[model samples]
Target: MTKVYLALAHQRQRWMNDLFQRGYKKKLKEEDLFELEERNTSSKLCDEFETNWKLVVKNAKQTGKRPSLLKAIQKTFGVRWCLYGLLALVKTIRLSQKSLTTTTTGEIINLGATDVLRFDFLPQYSQYILIGPIVSIVFVFLLWQVVGVSSLAGFLVIIIGFIGYSLTGPCFGKLRNKTALRTDKRVRMMNEIVSAMRVVKMYAWEKPYASLIEKMRSSEIDKLLQSSYFRALSISSSYVANKVTIFAVFVVYVSLGGRLVSSQVFAALTWINLMRFPTATIFGWGVEYLSESIVSIRRIETFLLLDEKEASILDDIKINTKRNSASIVFENFTAAWDDVNLAYVAENRDATQRKTLENINLQVNDKKLLAVIGPTGSGKSSFLNAILSELPAKTGGVKVRGRIAYVGQIPWVYSGSIKDNILFGEEYKPERFRAVVKACALTKDIQSLQEGEETLVGERGVTLSGGQKARVNLARAAYRENIDIVLLDDPLSAVDSNVANHLFHECVCRYMKNKVNAFYESFIMYG
Candidate 1:
């Protein structure tokens, strides 16, 4: 009876080995199949998104409005499939415009470049933060099944390693903050140096500035290196933990007089190896990424919370689309540029301050022309700014009952055709275009140019001369159809006497006849 039972058991063992081999082979085949399937799935996702984005862009162009990424996605894909990364990006862009007035250019750049990218890492490895623990628990159960009570020793070592890795999260967060700040400083310094390179060369400040930038770069690199060291330790610890877990499990199993069969021993090692990745590698990386993301979120939150431009300040001025009686009225008005401190100053009433334009009492009823004459720092620009609602009111109110067309002191132009600059996004009318060109004295200039109205002016009108740029600026304001007030802030300063006279008489007097014109001239006031 004993011989018969032993023979039956041996037969069953052989059958089980054959079954396991077949299953393992099938798993390898399935892995290959799933890999290709995943690749195709990812490709399809990207292609679909590209098609939808193109449609959104086309619609935006036709309607002349900026496309919302969220709307585009919601239209094509269901709301349930919404990606938080895209949502966060859209929100950042919307809030960032408000931050522009308060935040530095470098800080804004870092938010886009570095802080936004931190979100990318979160979706990839962040799942491991939850999955790691659950998976580790399952692995421990499987390890116990194979190696019995000895598996506890290995799990204890793993738990210790996990706790150690988790503690480094705060350290990584601190390091990331320092690196980000240094990077912003470095970028800001670079921008300032590049912008003032000509002046820097004149003053021989190359070496000093270079040294300062190098010092900043060195500090940034040091923080990054420290972060890299932590990353290396994490990766190395994963390998060490795997080896140590196997060693401890075997040591305890042998000491407990458990006879290790080849199948059971290999199974135990395999489970430990699987546990190492989720427990150590992925968990460590996920924690670090989470820490970095937290820091980034706080930075972005602070930026988005900064004060925005006060559109309400401009609500006081009434808009009237009539030429019957154009006017501007300022009653006990005091204006200032530092709007952030305006409320505080108003509350205290004893702050020592130099007002931009103070205690101004003025009115222009049924006026054709009103000219303001002042010295360099005599609030000439401030007066126009107060009317524009750019300089916020500190004490009293300003009433502007007309649509204003302002030609600033420095003639500004963007990178576009001269005609585009003149039209300024208004519908092009051939007769009106010709008249504005003639009135602003730009007809001869355009005719002399190689491309006439199609000539592409470089950035800030670098390709055009100062007088030509000023004429282009004036033409922009002049080309408008229903402008009731024209504010000329030293517009004629760059032009010669002949051109200035032509612009004043032809454009301001005849072309803008019946309109209220405010001229800020240094020498004379024309009314």
Candidate 2:
């Protein structure tokens, strides 16, 4: 029985390896193998098969020598420590590259969130280009000694190759810059499409927006094609340079009346072949990487150097012993979304300096409901933003005595189950959960769902109605047990009058009335 099982496992491994090799060669899609019923085995077995197959593919790509030749070489040579060292170095490089790529990606995301524009993304990629050339030069020098090549000839070849490589830099830079522009345009288009998807559908602007996105994508593809052409030319040139150097060395040796013995000739050729992979990799991918890294570094530097919003003085304010009580006091405060530094930079300083809110004295005592009433463009929302320290305070400041919970004018929902959103990271309590759900009038909505509170809410609650989304948003705030203040930005606006009244009475009046609440309003409520 044991032998039979072992035989089966070996056969399965061989079959999977063959399948993977064919997939690598583009003979079949790897996904097709997964779809086969017979291939459905234990995950552990599958993982082992995959690991072995990857090793096989990697070895095949790195060396063109037959298995028999490799075995013979291994037998002739005890252990090639240089080859082992090279493999280890390559592994280290790959691990470092992965970590750097992840960190750089995170930095790019953070920089995008800031106000900085037109950041170059090339610098991260360009470092490899600088490092690769140095390694290649050292390896070539060592190769010259091993092959007993004339010093003068080797030096001439090195100088020629370096000059040829240097000439491609300007072309690569130009291509990279063009590619960067196209990439920026594509990103902008994608952001616009995502943000205005609802408006686009409502206004029947789908065709136009789609066309615009397609146009940008097409333009980006064109830029990529042009860049690829330059990249291909550089790679081909590097390969040709290697060939030329070998020919030149042979000619120089013969001209110098140097007897080229078979052993010497073969050794030189073999060493050259060994150098080909790293040399080609350095000149080809290294050029592209350098161009990209330079752009990335510049963009990151520009973003990092941008004048960020000054840290709020209130950040250092300690919470008082009155944890259950919350109060906010803004004394003759003047605030704006615009940067104060911009006023100094502008030609017409006074004209450019526009305050969103000016001389706004406001106070909301602990456990009191404060209503802020205003007409259109009356800076009602700005008042709330100022309290949150989102808008910069030009004169005076806001003092908040406790933690805050804010429900924005636009209801925000994350992708998760309803229960998860409400619970957030807090310890789940069934009683409090039930109470908040009922208070927010989400009981019926939860019951109607197939999975109840555990039902998955699609991205940004796309699956829920406007009123349902607003209620869930409200429930999340209401469910927080430790909230000392609640800032409601017309939460009732999305629901019907009946539901609004119910929510106001149950959720706001009964529950939140005891907590300090700042409610922004644009209309009168009969209730």
Candidate 3:
């Protein structure tokens, strides 16, 4: 009885393997085959595999060429049956899809929301460029061919409309992008505020912070508006040029009798005269498009050419601030950047000097969370920046000390959830996270809000209070687990003293004491 059972199992496995082999051949033929005369036979008793043909090919090798079985089956049963198979498959899929629709969780949208906002293709697609004009001219010609000379009238109108569109697209995009970039530049200044906490709290410098941010934002707006004005002027210029061409065409059309000339020779002349207006209008539109493109491309080029982070790579600036010193050291250290400095012109301001720091000698050894305080003209922020290697002493630089977490002088947040603002993708440490929150004393403040961590901070955290915003930033920096050395540049110039003192002592100062306990056995690690 055991031998019989083993034999039956082995036989079933062999039959399944054969069926799978046949199905994979891409054959449309039905797999349910048998001698109808032998009704009571053992092989005729099988039921499962005798259904659809496609299921047999389930485990087939994925390949470029169709399998042999499919071809043979198609030849025998014919290709007409293949259509039915595909139709059935599609119907089955649709039915299955409809049935599962409610339970389905994931879907993909083309040109994702995040991408459309971030990427800039205006310069490439802007009609202000030469390609834009040339293409428009060709398009006019083809349109004329399709709709006859009467189409030129609409084409002229369209050209006019395109001119308006071309003018606005680049200018708008540029202003928006500039505003965004300026906001970033402003936020990066937060170092100045963080390092100046003691005096800031003593003086209650909310007004100063508010004023500074307002100025920066104003500067960005002014720049955007100015760029937009230029774009508008460019477009208007193109519009004028096009009108000139249109006027010229009207002059010719009126002088030539303003009617279609059917004669081959005269018709050619009519075509020329009709297109005269269009050509000029197209030229004008092209100008507008190209101008915008040039400005956008030029702006994009400057940033892209900078020896900065490429958009494709996700590497971070590895900051080392282990020593909050008034001095820095570089022993037998080499920072190399070949021919990158000569790209920029300094003009009359040391006109030939393009490099900022190279093989630079500097010191800052006041390691007590030393204040990098200096007059506005003095390179106070620059000094701290140099220590962290954020500025890079002429690129590929080495400092060989400390772990640093940077908080800029300017207070700026993002159009993200509050949790995103505070955590910033760092590993979640509940106790440490709470400690930072409590240290910054934003615990009760945020919890009282309805959304708590899920709160959607509008653009630049527009909805947050200055203190709340600063605390959020502190929370972000505090979460960097390995950060021992804290290098702040006036980050707290906007915060109150109580929160500043607590955060300074416990998170930064007391970390020296707590770091030893890290090696103990009971430190419950999260992941």
Tens digits of per-residue lDDT for model 2, 363-467? 888888888887868888888877776666778988888878889888988899999988888889999999999999999999999999999999888889899
Preferred candidate (lDDT higher): 1 or 3? 1
Report every candidate's CA lDDT: 0.79, 0.65, 0.49
Error of 2 at 493 (Å): 1.8
C-alpha RMSD (angstroms) for model 3: 22.6
Listed in order, each prediction's TM-score against the native is: 0.71, 0.64, 0.40
Count of backbone clashes for each model? 0, 19, 45
Model 2 alpha-carbon drift over 4 Å, by segment: 1-154, 170-174, 191-207, 249-284, 303-318, 321-324, 340-351, 415-420, 423-459
Candidate 1 lDDT score at position 340? 48
TM-score winner between candidates 2 and 3 = 2
The sequence of per-residue lDDT tens digits that candidate 3 reaches over residues 1-527 is: 99999999998788677667777886736544433455333343222212222232322325422223333234333433222221111111222211222211110111122112222333223223444445556655754563355446535654665566555556655565565456555654454566565568889996888799789878977987786686666556555644554454444455656653345324444444454433444444444444443443333322222333221211222333333332335443333222232113233234244443445553334344344445553555655545544344433333434455666667668889877787887877778777777766777887988998788888767678887887787667766776544555565667667666665566555543322111101111212
Q: Order the candidates by lDDT, highest first.
A: 1, 2, 3
Least accurate 10 contiguous residues by lDDT in model 3: 516-525
Number of clashing residue pairs, candidate 2: 19
